[model samples]
Target: MAKSNILARTGNEAMAEAMRQVNPDVVAAYPITPATEIVQIFASFVADGLVDTEFVPVESEHSAMSACIGAASAGGRVMTGTSSQGLALMAEMLYIAAGLRLPIVLSDVNRALSSPINIHCDHSDTMMVRDSGWIQIFSENAQEAYDNMVQAVKIAEAVKLPVVVTTDGFIISHGMERIEILDDAEVKKFIGDYKPEHYLLNFEKPITVGALDLTDYYFEHKRQEIEAMKASTPVIIAVGSEFGKKTGRSYGLFEKYKMEDAEAVMIAMGSTAGTAKVKIDELRAKGLKAGLLKPRVFRPFPKEEIADALKGAKAVAVMDRSDSMNAQEGPLCLEVKAALYDKAANKPVLNYVYGLGGREIKPEDIGTVFDDLFEASKGKEKPGVSYLGVRE
Candidate 1:
């Protein structure tokens, strides 16, 4: 095992520390609420000569991502940070980066999108880009955020896909926690060196990139991208396993908490999972077989694995921090239901859209979800979308 240090740091601080350890070649970012501190701290590292990163402070988030794309195309290990509107501004460039197969790692501090202009914890930002072809990882706390940031670089470079590591804005991003940080040397050794198979900087075998492809090869290229995502599942598992061996902190697509003999389960992502775990323990102590499944990786869906994990559960409750506004279930709930279709045909699955605009979700509130799940299992409560913690 590697020698590690326990430090009290916020999620943003942990992520910035991880970036300083990784020491990427280029970082182009725009400051945004909650997420600003990540790149802000990284920039200080660059200024103080702590790392040899070329920090580009752009005028807008779109320009920041554009610069990252340019730097990455030139075969540089690149990264950046953004949240909410910043992510929304970079939407166009995000697709381009993924389509071109640039391995740029991004840190996304999850915050609600603007309408009423709230700057707080929510999944609306990341959920908006769920299908943008980037691998998404959600951190439960500062420790996971730091761990995930290190792993994301390896994962992105291995699969040649952009990755987004998200921490709940203010909840994890601002909340301080004790994080076990690996030695800088260990992180460098684990991530290894970036040696791209092909890049624009290669003079001997120069190739065209971003050429307009209307119909001839667009579909085929898209198919290749699809296959890459499918291929990434095993790579994710392998990397997680290796990270575990190095530091004894293993990770997977989702975490199953007390699911051994669970009759009622709550599936969630990000910081809500932390809250759900407490309620699960309380329910278990009350002699109820309640459990929690927290998804760390949201992209690639992990449908089969998720289905397998929820196989024994009689009732399942999915908590979504962002609503899809489809008048049905939230994004996470919709996907969870789809995953359970064939395997748990008769299982009752409920959808609870909670914590929008950073509304507080407490352990007692989670207890209510389990209570509803138990009732659903008994065929008393009908499963549907419930606005949890919302005044209805």
Candidate 2:
């Protein structure tokens, strides 16, 4: 493995460093709270000649994505960053970017969607675009955020699909932590050059993009996208393996912590997994067979693998940072329930919604969850859909 430099930086700054190393052809972005710093830092890199990237400052997030789509289609490597409302604003272009099979890397700072207008860490933004056909990877901390951003370029280009690398808004994005960064030469070699098979700039071969296909061809095109999304699983694993070899940091679809012989388990994603790990350790010392499963990739869902992991547990709880507003459970819970639905093991699955609008999730809150899971395991009581760390 190559020697890495350790630096103390926020998740947003780490992602910007990865961007500078990748040094794409174009970066089109608008400022949004939490996520604004990522592109802002990258823009400075462009200005200082640290990176040879064309930074396009657009008026709106929609325009930012639109410009990215245009640049990407023209055979340029493209990237951008945005948060909650900004992501919602770019929803339309998100589909377009994926439909066009443009390999644009997006850094999404996960924040709660607003009705009351607040800024903080949550999964509402990324969850809203779950089915937009983009490959999504959630980071547990600043290091993972940086690593994922670098790997996203390879994954996106390989699959001819856009990739969303998400970090918790204020939690990971604004919080500084010590992270190991790959050398610039190593990153450049790892990402390689973005050479498209077909691009608008290739005048030698004329091709049209985003042509209107009403019914006859639209379905087939979408099917191709589905296949590509499915095919991304192996590609993700391959890229992760290569990255691990270089950096000695291995990544999988999901990480299982102390799940072996565990009777009770909790599933979650992003930075909350860090807290959950701490809680799991505390519970383990108390002789409680508690464990945690953190899903790194959310888009492909990893149904079979997740089902296999939870099959042995007597009771399971899924933590969702965003409320689905479905009158029942959140998005992560729904996916977990669906994944385990066919499993013959009669594990009782529970849902807990927490950390919305920058709400703090303490270790005691997580301990309470394990207590409830232990109770549910003993068949004493059933903990159904519940809220964690919320004022009732």
Candidate 3:
């Protein structure tokens, strides 16, 4: 019930607006397709003096993340944006950022990685860095993109880890939608201020960063990082709950749509979940118990919670926009299967890799997934990976 501004904004514009409101101390970014406008619009804010920020126009995404690391080490709240190749180039620095425990926030427009030179919506880029140790949050549309960006700041700072907020390229990035934006004052009040316990700026507490850790103590540091990630789930949930109380939109690890009493369930992320919801409704109208499970947080995967949600379903299908290419299941599917291995092992779980390279996934396509789930439940179809919307 917070005071808000109703506006039609593309996902890129919404992310940029959220950045303007947060007004981090530093933003070193390189422009890339779909994600370019996020930093592009923020740059204009810098030029117009709307926010007091040091906008560094870096030569490449690698340098952008490098610069962000330096700024963050100096106790400055930092953020940036990138896409497919941009994210790939920044991959090396990404590991360093998270290992060093820098609270840097990144906006990643989810685009397919290139080998054949494609620029379109897909989760490949984000999934590529799944183990890089950053908290990953996916947005379903423009509104979630905006809200996630705002909440990401708090999550990163609270956990002292880097965070990546992603939106499917062009799908959500270019699509405009009516969004309820919270007032700037509310956003400002909600985030509060950044106060680092140890930073380069603190002369009295000077400490070495990015120091080479050899076999002597590297293991302990890595273990601590692992524990931190394990501990971040609560931080993520708490911040999401607080943001909801302030903005009237609550978020969680994932969304379970019509899961109660559902015999067939399809799990997905990003904009695909929106389409799946429609299909679930239609199936319900036809007297089919279909449902959808949409994961908002990919990293620090909510294994137990996901297992619990799918426990009641007779059949579950996990839809992934990117394939693992390991001749097994897609990334999201693999996670879902692993989650159900012990808890819901008896249930039939299917994997569907769809919409790669921005191929459209219609409501009918979602219905097809549900159909497969039902068929698998009845032991008519084996549970495994199936490429959807592809010429097999």
Candidate 2: residue pairs that collide: none
Question: Model 3: per-residue lDDT, tens digit, 1-392?
Answer: 68889999999999999999999999999999989999999999999999999999989999999999999999999999999999999999999999999999999999999987789999999999999999999999999999999999999999989999999999899999999899998899988899999999999988998888999999999999999999999999999999888778899999889988998988899999998888888899999999888999998999999999887888888899998889999999888888888673777778888999999999998887887888888888665888899986
- Per candidate, the number of residue pairs that clash is 0, 0, 0
Instruction: Pick the winner on lDDT between candidates 1 and 3.
Output: 1
lDDT agreement of model 2 with the native: 0.94
TM-score: model 1 vs. ground truth: 0.99
TM-score of each: 0.99, 0.99, 0.98
In Å, residue 112's CA in model 1 sits off its true spot by 0.4
Off by over 4 Å in 1: none
Clashing pairs in 3: none
Write the residue-wise lDDT of candidate 1 on 1-392 in tens digits.
89999999999999999999999999999999999999999999999999999999999999999999999999999999999999999999999999999999999999999898999989999999999999999999999999999999999999999999999999999999999999999999999999998888999889787999888999999998999899889999999999999889999999999998999999999999998888887788889999989999999789999999998888989999998888889999889888888664668888898999999999999989888999988888675878899996
Query: Residue 384 error for model 3, in Å?
Result: 1.2
- The segments of candidate 3 whose C-alpha lies over 4 angstroms from its true place after superposition are none
lDDT of 1 at 33: 97
The 0-to-1 C-alpha lDDT of every candidate, in the order given, reads 0.93, 0.94, 0.93
Off by over 4 Å in 2: none
